[model samples]
Target chain A: DVKVTQSSRYLVKRTGEKVFLECVQDMDHENMFWYRQDPGLGLRLIYFSYDVKMKEKGDIPEGYSVSREKKERFSLILESASTNQTSMYLCASSPSDSSYEQYFGPGTRLTVT
Target chain B: AQSVTQLDSQVPVFEEAPVELRCNYSSSVSVYLFWYVQYPNQGLQLLLKYLSGSTLVKGINGFEAEFNKSQTSFHLRKPSVHISDTAEYFCAVTEGNSGYSTLTFGKGTMLLVSP
Candidate 1:
């Protein structure tokens, strides 16, 4: 069974604070993604990494950045947290050869106050 | 670019009743379709996926979906649902040729099963 683990299950940060959400996959998948899910807005992609040190912006990448220094770990960075950034963040990983299905980690619910 | 639309925002059903959640997608090239379930405060879990070969795909938890290319729809259905089946279901699509494999998800349909 594939296991994707997130660093934090829940987090609360003040406005203008820096936040980091980490994700690690034991499957050694080459593709990792970060998404923020909102009610009625759906799961919008924030950023994705295809390989180490390679990143691409998704539909909504503003105020967010990602790091993939290693194949097993992917991190999501909030430049400066705001109230609007408060939401559930999900991390997913898929194999490079077969990207059809992705395994997701338990999400992190971030609250910015 | 690929996009997915889940027409129904909410579907309420009784225990042991049948239920259907509609999903439509738009993409010029070949696409892969998937349905995911998210419990309260949990991450999304892959329910089913339609890659190739078969149009009717069955997934875990007795959930199934039919891929209709002509209609551009992949609707999920279950014959008998349980109270534990209550969750948010999302439909997603990815372009076959894009190589990125990033998914575009629908707004999601909330399934409320009551006794």
Candidate 2:
């Protein structure tokens, strides 16, 4: 079984604060992704990393950045958090050679005030 | 580019009744389709996937989906649902031959199963 774990299950931050959401996968998958899920919006991709130091922007990457210094870890960074950024964050990983099936981690619900 | 659309936002059903969740996609190239279920406060789980070979794909939890190329639809169905089956269902698509995969998801459909 594949295991994807996030750093926090819930977080609260004030406006203008910096926030970091971390994800780690034990399956040694080559692709990792970050997404924010909101009601009526489904899940919007924030950023994705295919390999170490390699990153790509998805449909909605504004105000967010990602780091993949190692294969097992992927971090999403909000340079300065805003109230609009409050939502559930999900981390997923998949093997590059597989059928594009992603394994998701329990989401982190972030609240910005 | 690939995109998915789930026509229904919510579906209400009673226990032991049949249900269907509709999904459609548009893409220039062939694509892979998937259906995922998310319980409250939990991440999405892969319920089924349509890759190749078979048009009718069966997945976990006694759910299944049929891939229709002409109409570009992949609709999920279950013969009889239970109260525990209440959850949100999302349909996603990605270019089939693209070496790197990035999914385009549809706004989910919420299934409310009652006793």
Candidate 3:
């Protein structure tokens, strides 16, 4: 079974604080993605990495960046946390050559104050 | 650009009752359709996908969806739903024949199953 794990299930941060959200997938998938889920907005992609050290911006990449130093680990960094950025963050991984099915992490609910 | 629309924002149904969630897509090119389910406080899970071949595709948890090219719709259906089936369902679409899968999702439909 494919297992995706996140660093935190819930997080609280003050405005202007820097924040890091970590995600790791046990499966050696090449494609990794970061998405933010909001009420009535559904899931919107923030960033994705096709390989280590290779990243691409998604639809909503503003106020956020991603790092994939190693294959299994992908991190989302908030340059400066803001109240409008509060939402549930999800990470997903999929095999680049084989299947397009994405396996997702439990999620990290971030609250900015 | 591809876009998806889920007609119902919320569907309330009794346990063991049949349910259907309507979805429509707008894209000039061909597209792949998908339905994802998210339980309360949980991440989204792939319920089913329609790439090609069959119009009626079956997925996990006894859920299925039909792809209609004429109407540009892909509606999800389940014969009998359980309380555990209550969750948020998202309809998504991606450009077909693409090297990468970048899905565009709809707002979502909240399925509330009552016992």
- The top-ranked prediction according to DockQ is 2
* Clashes found in each candidate (C-alpha, N, C closer than 3 A): 0, 0, 0
> A31-110 in candidate 2: lDDT tens per residue?
99999999999999999999999999998999999999999999999999999999999999999985899999999999
List residue ranges in candidate 2 displaced over 4 A.
Answer: none
DockQ of each: 0.69, 0.78, 0.62
TM-scores for every candidate against the unseen true structure? 0.98, 0.99, 0.96
Instruction: Give a tens-digit lDDT track for model 3, residues A2-113.
Output: 9999999999999999999999999988889999999999899999998999999999999999999999999999999999999999999988752467888999999999
- Candidate number achieving the greatest TM-score relative to the actual structure: 2
Worst 10 residues of 2 chain B by lDDT: B95-104
DockQ winner between candidates 2 and 3: 2
C-alpha RMSD of each candidate structure in angstroms: 0.9, 0.7, 1.2
Better of 1 and 2 by TM-score: 2
Question: Order of all candidates by TM-score, from best down to worst?
Answer: 2, 1, 3
Task: Arrange candidates, best lDDT first.
Answer: 2, 1, 3
Among these predicted structures, which one has the highest lDDT?
2
Which tens-of-lDDT digit does each residue in B1-115 have in candidate 3? 8999999999999999999999999999988899999999888899999988999999999999999999999999999999999999999998855445777889999999999
TM of chain B, each: 0.97, 0.97, 0.97
The candidate with the higher lDDT, 1 or 2, is: 2
Docking class of 3: medium
Model 1 C-alpha lDDT per residue in residues B1-115, reported as the tens digit of each score: 6889999999999999999999999999989999999998788899999999899999999999999999999999999999999999999998866455788999999999999
